[model samples]
Target: MPDPEEPDVVSATDLETPPGLEPPPTAVRDLLAPDRRFVSARRNLGSFAKTGDAARLRRGIAQYVRTGYGGAGTMSRRLGSVSRTARSLSQVLDPGAADRGLDRALLQGNSVAEITDAVVEAACSSDGTLDAEASRESIRNALSDLLGLYSDVDLLRLTDAQREFVIESFVAHDVYRRFALDVGKHLVDNAPTATIGLSRLKQARNYIRQTIAESFRLLREAGQSMTTAHVRSTVANALTNSLVVFEGYLA
Candidate 1:
């Protein structure tokens, strides 16, 4: 979990973080006053990262729940063209989306989720905090899937990756929205230990990463086009299937 617990007057270099990941500037802080949740979460993150005591992580989660974890990170959004730009894409809606059962079968595929997510994410964003690097990740994921699953397809034409960006951004946003939301829950649910919690957190993040990537692979094999209704319906359907997958894993 990220916490903006640093000094209010840090340098320009202070915000630099590793590529392909959301920066640590997630939690809101006052100019002169430290946020209580951020201060506590920072302490917990530092402690768990250092000592491997899952109790610290667990306690932090409880604190977050008590403090109201709502506006602290990314938010969930509708799956269709969630932005004004999405409307522009609608001009190109595939005429065959209804005819070919693309919306029916591929709704469970990766492409629909990727495309709808790509658009709807804008609607979900509260302000202009969109990350530039999200597209790079989705594109890579989309391209890799093309190489693995649909090698004969033209790379330039295949574009579930934009959808990939939407979902990736969604995940990144969700994590910060609620500190320690799921990172330590599994470990603490069974037993509280930071080492186990850290490991569980890794597994959870990996699950998210793999699921979205696997989901992106099915978006192409044709020039991409779909109605806004198709977009919403397919993505919604894809999300349901994803939940089933997630539930199976959790079970």
Candidate 2:
């Protein structure tokens, strides 16, 4: 018989249909809201770019940064950061170049988490006291700058499928980050040996990645349209179930 105190080794069968696995609003909203905002900002930036009105573009960038980056207060600081980044883009106004950049950023398997990580790593000093707020500001600015490169025409021309792919990719990356954080928190709290913690975390990451891919596949196979709510529910259910299994392992 299996040891009662040993952590349960989860399998494909174990992951199916977790009982009473209701998705929590906190997790759902945390993942969904930013994704929606990011998608919306891309669409709006495309619209503004089409007009070729510099003032409108600036205003749109500020609004997008405020909404998509965070919330309402401290608008001036965010706007300034965004504006500075926008100013740094190549002034040649070549829509083709801008389009290529946008494609590389969004469509080439790039994730917001990756961009944020890059910015944070670059911004941090030798000391452990990293200015997290500054890192976020830089990320917002970087995104705004990238969007500023393309004309509205370039952005508007993208097919629906392209936009959907970008949105889904962002959601997937966020899900991965959340799962990593959850596993890290558990390991930290439990004070497991480094080797054990690292091994468990790696396993958890692989499982989460596979679960997310399968969830998307099933949705597509069923002819169901993907939405923030649906993705959130699917991810949250998987994460909750995985955590239960992980806690069992820790026990």
Candidate 3:
């Protein structure tokens, strides 16, 4: 027979031994077996680059857990596990995540709840720390995504790949995303009424909204936890600060 340590049911929360209880790490390991890990990675990617109007990140994760894992039952169970883990982490809400989702809602047209839910999920799951390798990859990814979004050259410089890479790599991922989100939200919330044309106003709104959305998505997908508000305030206080080295790149 199998060793007594192996249990019939493997779960993230089931961290006890057979007949009694297993430990969480063992359960997480069993659940994250190579094949399961592959599935999780794939589902995560699906959450990132879907074609349809952006859906709530929370909904996407929940659905992935539900169907991709076991079902609604599994989602509830995993949620319980995640909730417990969340209690241990610091609780700074990133306004950028909220603004990014809100901007997306205004543009691609999702509900406020859907947008807010996604923002909350992003904020909660954010880790904000990327080592050298991941940071390099993130910089490349950020630039590519930005180029695709901007498609124009005047508003923000697109060259200086090396400088941009350095800025992105050295900066705190969550903090940068937070600031970008803040800038975007503030612009949207305080768009000048004196603007001449509807076209100008719409363009400005789209630009700010898209910028925040892209930054928020990048930050969340990278697993950084810094909120948009934090980043914004930090940058505003001292534009040359280490928290947002991007401004340094501009200089």
Candidate 4:
């Protein structure tokens, strides 16, 4: 029989009803409202918009992916000097610190918040400024709301179908947070705007989400076990395919 758990089985109208509680949000546009308190996330919004620096976005996402499946990954391999310094301080002074930091690289079963912390930490610009610790907090909230539905699922040992579902949702959620959380003028063409182009923003967010999700649909089947290395490979594929979506995508 066909694997009932395959992501393809879930239609657009489908809401993931996880056992006891109400269905977790499958359409996250409503939950993506920017946390204006996170000034750094706001800075991230404005900075990434102009530079077309998709790589930085990819790097942040890679951290989240690695965290889910245990990856001290190569995303940091090519970070420019500024980002390198930030990662060193956070990952080194923090992760490798003898006194109070991580004694080893993160392995499987790490918490999802590590995704937000790693992304925010790697993107930090200075030592103690909120610029590094922006008033924003969307990634954590969005991912928590969406992935929380799978609380019973063992992320490290997912079937291919479940793994793909997680990957697609992650890409969509990441893209959604970047845009949906832009409650400021960072993503628009003008200031003094009333709505912040909410319509266009929605169009863009949904479009990217759909695009990345479709990329995973092209796969043949969900046969493999999501081993650590397999998770790494798929995460890399997710990043590459996600970049492809952004290439034709605007804003």
Cα deviation of 132 in candidate 4 (Å)? 9.2
TM-score of each: 0.34, 0.29, 0.20, 0.37
Model 4, TM vs. native:
0.37
lDDT digits (tens) for residues 1-251 of candidate 3 = 12211212334332221111112233232432334422442343233223211222223333333445455344334324222222211121222222422234343455433433443443244333222222223333333444455554221212433223323322323223322222222222232321211222223223223333445446546664333323333222222222122211222
- On TM-score, the leading prediction is 4
- The parts of candidate 3 lying over 4 Å away from their true place are 1-131, 152-251
Q: Where in model 2 is the C-alpha error above 4 Å?
A: 1-166, 179-183, 188-192, 226-251
Candidate 3 has an lDDT of 0.30
Q: Which regions of candidate 4 are displaced past 4 Å? A: 1-139, 147-164, 176-193, 220-226, 248-251
Cα lDDT listed for each candidate: 0.36, 0.35, 0.30, 0.37
Least accurate stretch of 10 residues (summed lDDT) in model 3?
14-23
How well is each residue in 24-117 modelled by candidate 1, as lDDT tens digits?
A: 2343222213355455545554565444454554444333433323321211132222222333233222332232212323433356336444
Tell me the tens digit of each residue's lDDT in model 2 across 21-75: 2132342334323245544434433343333333333333333435544533332
State candidate 2's TM-score. 0.29
Error of model 4, residue 116, in angstroms = 11
